[model samples]
Target: MSPTLQNEALQSRAEALGQSLPPLLAEAEMLAATLMLGEHGRRRAGSGDEFWQYRAAHQGDPARAIDWRRSARSDGHFIREREWQAAQSVTLWVDPAKSMAFSGGRERPPKGDRARLLALALAVLLLRGGERVGLAGLAQPRSGRSQIVRLAARLAGEPEAGDYGAPETAGMVGHGRAVFVSDFLGPIEPVEAALSRAADRGVRGALCQILDPAEEEFPFDGRVIFESMSGSMRHETQQAGELRSRYLARLAERKDRLSELARAVGWQFSTFHTGAPAQSALLWLYRALEGGR
Candidate 1:
């Protein structure tokens, strides 16, 4: 590309990002406001510092673990237990692939937009709860309102040139959790490799597959030209409807594979469509993280 063309492309991308950033941030905040804030309770006693509850002292309970004052008030000896605190660092990855920019119609936003919204909203809740959140491979995990702005800017900046996206796991926090948002239309090797690396580091997380309604329902009929969002792959089919079965089959297979991979690595997996409300996915991600603890 010529210098003039490259500059023009950069300017266009900047303008697009500027246009999208404010609404994305506003929507994320609104979505996050609907949820309760504070550190999520693990509901079980472990090695955490925060006191969860007082239970009757067990036969084998250590003398130091007993609460003498509480025991005096109670008929039986009591033990103060601390809640389990795990997954301190949460890394988020929203797919930057051009395919994630696809939307089925004017009514719904792009898959990438939904993914970013979910990621940011979840971050807001996590940050409020004192969890460090960051963009995978782009930013170090930090907790603050400022991190939300940093994430939104990065998410709206530019689209990657590819048909699909892959997770970046090199700098993953050991024993920390991660959330990866992608369409997962790419080959399975990259996804498998990334999760394997994460597992090796004792990192477990969630995989959110964002898709367009058209991709799942296969509403196209008759002749259609199917081209990738990056314009790198294309196919002209006279009987688009006839290929629906094969396309749906492949999609199901991919989803099954993702689910299996997630299970193998002790992670959670979910599928969300652009047509649905974003809050549901955000809620699911929040609960999944809390449950993992």
Candidate 2:
């Protein structure tokens, strides 16, 4: 493409993103608000009202360690703990590969958009819960709600070169979790490899497979021409209906393999369709993190 055409394309993309972002952010915040009302609140030990436990005051116990009411009833003085002290860091990665740009219908959002929304919403929830959030291969895990807008901006921007597939785990050094949001439609080897490396580093996390409704249902009929996002492959089917069964079978096989890989690495795996409510995926992710797997 010529430079002028490239600029026009970029401008068009920017405009589309601007139109879509407000709704996405609003929906995400609404979902987060609902989740906050439930038990999905922060589980980490921090400044909170909920009671965790009480233990015998030790030698290094601070002067404020005594719980007056509880200590009065007990022979030994005890210190109260709200919860675990360390706040977890979660690294999120949404596949920005060309394939994610495909949408089955005009009404449906692209898989990439859905993935970005989920990643951002999940980040919102995590930040609210006092956990650090970071974008895999892009940003370092950091705390505070301010990072949310920065993440949103990066998601709307064009993908950088080599920004494809699962993220690299080399920079994830702590015992933090990693969340991978993607279609996971490509070969399984790279996914497996990336999860393996993170597992080796003691980073447990979850995998969310975002798919278009048509992709999951294979709702095509009659004639159809399928072209690869990279334009490297093409297939034409005269009876698209006839291929549905085979396509579905292959998709199921892929999901099964992904599940097995996730299990092997002690990570959780779940699937979400763009047509479904985003809250469901966010809830599942929040629970998975709470489960501390």
Candidate 3:
């Protein structure tokens, strides 16, 4: 998109998302730009199929890696050949369940909206990068611009109200990279199990855990009412100071468990609370991935 259109797009997005969107979009854009420059995926270098310069050979270099045609035209000393394939396919999975729509901490957008903007922003990056990007709910097909528009419309219309594991994922398998976005407020173990399932199937992926800062720190200062996004759980809070330490411990456990599960399943996991400007986490991750982190 033109820089003007891009800014307008982001502004439109932020407006739709209430107030907590600018930071999220900024983060996602930074991530998108960094991801394109990263080594993990085939990047679009101007023309869709134009050849780019090569790097030095590395260990276990495959015979296919050698560009014989190029070598025939130059001093052939390297055996490791890196061909720029078409832009790598990227599939983004977003959880639209009501739980993901939870909103807190000084009128932040609901988690669902944040996740949508996040996904859309990434889609903008991917599409702009000439990558064939698809957007899917838990179990949906490879989406196109129309599908993404539908997703955006869904966000604009209902905001939230959906199931987490819709069994649609069984049919979709991204050959390259899959990005999973969710709040993960539900029983965390099941989500890990799902990730494990994906890993066993050879699906390389990353997870961006979108969270409301309220979940990280029990910010309730007085008699506060707490409700679950799932609509089946609720807790009345009259005292947070007494529970702060315990809550912090549990939160720490949650973080550790998420990290462990991600490591165990071979997926990169990141946690982002609502209070943070999304750009930092997204850029940090983009830089890490670019650096092969």
Candidate number with greatest TM-score: 1
Report the poorest 10 consecutive residues by lDDT, candidate 3: 284-293
What is the per-residue lDDT of model 3 for residues 1-293, given as tens digits with 9 covering 90 to 100? Answer: 89999999888876776644445555545656654544334532333344555655567778776767656767653543233555545556677677776677556866766666667666655555455556544324333455444434443434345444321244435445566778765567567666666677666666778888877777777687677666666788788567888988977887778778777866677888767765655554443322321
Q: Which stretches of candidate 1 lie over 4 Å from their true place?
A: 1-17, 37-39, 42-50, 68-76, 84-87
Cα lDDT listed for each candidate: 0.88, 0.81, 0.60
lDDT (tens digit, per residue) of candidate 2 on 1-293: 99999999989998988886677777667777776644335555566677778878899879686797888997889888786545678898888887788788888888888888888888888887678888877788888878887777667767543424655664575678998888898778889889988988889999999999988998889999988777767899899999999999999999999899999988999899988887888889888877763
Ranked by lDDT, the better of candidates 2 and 3 is: 2
RMSD of 1: 2.6
Model 3 residue runs over 4 Å out of place are: 1-76, 79-83, 137-151, 154-168, 284-293
Question: Positional deviation of 56 in candidate 3, in angstroms?
Answer: 5.2
Model 2 error, position 6 (Å): 12
User: For every model in order, what is the number of clashing pairs?
Assistant: 0, 0, 5
Query: Which ranges in model 2 have alpha carbons more than 4 Å from their true place?
Result: 1-24, 38-50, 53-81, 160-164
Order the numbered candidates by TM-score, best leading.
1, 2, 3
User: How far is each candidate from the true structure, as Cα RMSD in Å?
Assistant: 2.6, 4.2, 8.8
Candidates in order, TM-scores: namely 0.90, 0.80, 0.68
